[model samples]
Target: MQYKTVELVIEGKTATLFLNRAESMNAMNIKMIDEITKALKEVAASSVNLLFITGKGRVFSSGGDLKTMLSSTDESMFHPVMDQIKNMIVTLYTMKAVTVSFINGAAAGLGLSLALACDYVKLEKSAKVAMNFINIGLVPDGGGHFFLKKRLGEHKAKQIIWEGKSIPANDALQLGIVDEIYEGDIEEQLTFMKTKMEARPIQAMIASKMIYSTQELQHLVETLNLETMNQLEMRNTEDHREGVAAFLEKRIPHFSGK
Candidate 1:
C-alpha cells in the first residue's frame, strides 16, 4: 500500500519500511503513526517473516512531532496523538515477524523507544541516540522507560533518562542498546542481516519473540496509558511551554517546576 509519511518495500521474502519524511528528520506524526500501524498489520498477515525498519536521509526519527504539538492550541488533540503512538508501538512490539531496526542516524525521544521495541537493532558507527524526554519536561513514552530498564538495569537507565544525554553509536554498542555497529557500506550491512535472518528458523524465531514479549512486555499497555496521562499534564505545564519555546528559539530552557 502507498503511504505519505512512510514507504514499504517488499523484495522476495524480505520487507523494508522506510520512514519517509526526511524533510522533518522523519519526525513521527499522527498520519505516520496510522500508516505504520496499518503497514505492520499488513506485514503481520503476510508471508514475509523478516521485517526491517529504518529511516530516510539524515535521521532515524527526531521523535514525536514536537513542533506540531507545541504549536497546537487544542489540548483535545494531544490524547489521540499519544493513543496513536501507543497503538503503533504496541503493534511493532507484538508483531509476528522478526523485526529489526537499522539505525542509520539519530534516534531520540520516541524514536529511541520505537527502535528499542524491535527484536534486533543494528546501527552505523556515526549513528546517534538519546532518551531526551526530560529535556522537554516530558516523561518517556512509547515504552522507552521499560525498554531501557529492561536492557540497562534500573540505576543506569534512570541516569540516562534523567540526564537526557545523547549517546554516540560506539557508546550505544558498548551499552548493548544496539546489536552491532558497522563501518562498511549500508547495502552490504543490510544484505548480511537479510542473509542471517534467512538462515534461522523463521517460525521458531517468531515464536521466541512472541513468548519473550508476552512475559517482559506485560505491563506495556498499562504503562502507555499512564504515560499518556502524564504527558498530557506535562504539556499543560509552564516548563513544557518553555522547553518548546527554547527549542525553537535555539536557546537554553529554564524550566520551573510549575
Candidate 2:
C-alpha cells in the first residue's frame, strides 16, 4: 500500500515498516500517527511471521511533531493520540509475529516508547535515545511511562523521565533497554535474527510472547477482554478484511480507511 508518512514492504514471512518522513526526522504528527496505526492494523492480520520497524534517515524518530502539538487548542484531541499509541504498543507486544526495532540514531520521547514496545531492539553504536517529555513541559505519553517503569524499575524510570537525559546506545544497552549494538551492516544482522526466528515454531513463539507480556499485567483477564473488544471493532473496518485477504492471497493490501 502507498502511504504518505510510512512505507510497508513484505518479503517472504517478514514485513518491514519504515517511517518515511526522513526530512522531519520521522516525527510523529497526526498524519504520521494515523498512517502508522493503519499500517500496524494491516500487519496484525497478515501472515507475516516477523515485523521490522526502522526509519529512513540518521534518526529513528525525533519524537512528536512540536508544530502539530502546539496547534491543537483542545487537550481532548491528545487522548486519541494516546489511545492510538497504547493500542500500537499493545499490538506489537501481543502480535503473533516477532517484532524487532532497528534504532539507527536518535529516538526521543514518544520515539523511545515506540522502540521499547518492540520485542527486540537493535541499536547503532552511535544511536541516542531519551525520554525528553519533561524538558518540553509535557508528560510522558505513548506508554513511555509504563514501559520505562516496567523495564527500568520505578526509581530509575523516574530519574530518566524527570531528568530528561539522552541515553547513548552503550548506556542503553547496559541499562537493558537495547538488546544489541551494531556498528556494521544492519541488514545482515536483521537477516540473522529473521533466520533464528523462522527456525522456531511460530505458534510457540507467539505463546511465549503472550506469556512474557502477560506476566507483568496486573489484570490479565481485563486486558484480554479489552483486546477482544478492540479486535471486534477492527474486524468491522474495510482495512481489516483487506489485510486478511491480502495475506491469504499473497498480495499487497490496499487500505482506504473506509
Candidate 3:
C-alpha cells in the first residue's frame, strides 16, 4: 500500500519501514498512525524475517503532533488516535517477524514507546531519547508504562517517566533502553543483523517471539487500553493546557498539578 507519512521497502528477508515525515521530525499524527497500522499489517502478512524500523532525516520521531493535539476539541479526537497507536504497538510486538528499531535520532514520547515495543533497538551514537509525558502533564500511553517497567524494572522506569529524563544514546545503551550504539552507516548494522539472521533459524526466532508475545504482551495490550482512558483524563487537565502552551511558546511550563 502507498503511504504518505511512511515508506515500506522489502529486500529479501528484511523489511524496512521508514517514517517519512522529516519536516515535522516524523511526528505521529492520526494520519501517520493509520498509515503505520496499514504498513504493519503488510509486514505481518509478508515473508519477511526481520522488520527494520527507522525514521527519516534528523530526528527519529518527536512523538505526537502537538499541533494536532492542542487543536483537538475533546476526548473524541484522542480515542481513535490512541486506539490506532495501541493496535500498532501490539501488532509490532506480536508480529511473526523479529523487530528492530534503528533509532537514528531523537525518540521522544510515544516514539520511545514504539521503540520499546520492538524486540531489539539500535541507536546512532548521537541519538536522544526520552519519555517526557510528565513534562506535558500526561500519562504514558501506547503501552509505554508496561514496556518500560518490563525492561527496566519498576523503580527505574517510574523514575525516568516521572522525572522526564532524556538521555544520550550511549547512556540509553548502558541502561538497556537500546541494545547497541553505532557511529557508522546503518548499512553496517543491517549487515550485522543479516549475518545473525543467517546463522539461526528464522522460524525458531519467530516462534520464540510469539511465545513471549502471548505470555507477556497480551496483558499489556489490555492494560494500555485502560491507560489510554487515564491519559485522556490527564489531557483534559489545566496542567496539560499550561504545558502545551509553554511548549509552543518556548518557555518553561508552570504546572500546578491540577
lDDT of each: 0.86, 0.77, 0.87
Q: Pick the winner on TM-score between candidates 1 and 3.
A: 3
Expressed as tens digits, the lDDT of each residue in 1-258 for candidate 3 is 889999999988789899999999999888898898899989899888888888989888889888878777577777878888888998898899989998988999989988888898888899989999888889888888998888899899998899887899878888877888878787788778878888988899899889888898768977798888788889889999898888889999999979
The reply for model 1, stretches above 4 Å from the true place, is none
lDDT of 1 by residue, 14-72 (tens): 88898989999999877888898888888877888888999988888999887677665
Give all candidate RMSDs, comma-separated.
1.3, 13.0, 1.2
**Clashes (N, CA, C under 3 Å) per candidate:** 0, 0, 0
Q: Give the C-alpha lDDT of model 3.
A: 0.87
Best by TM-score: 3
State the lDDT of candidate 2 residue by residue for 123-147, as single tens digits.
9899999887655444566667667
Clashes of 3: 0
Would you list the clashing residue pairs of candidate 2?
none
Model 3 pairs whose backbones collide:
none
**Deviation of model 1 at 175, angstroms:** 1.8
Runs of candidate 3 with Cα error greater than 4 angstroms are none
Candidate 2 vs candidate 3, TM-score winner: 3
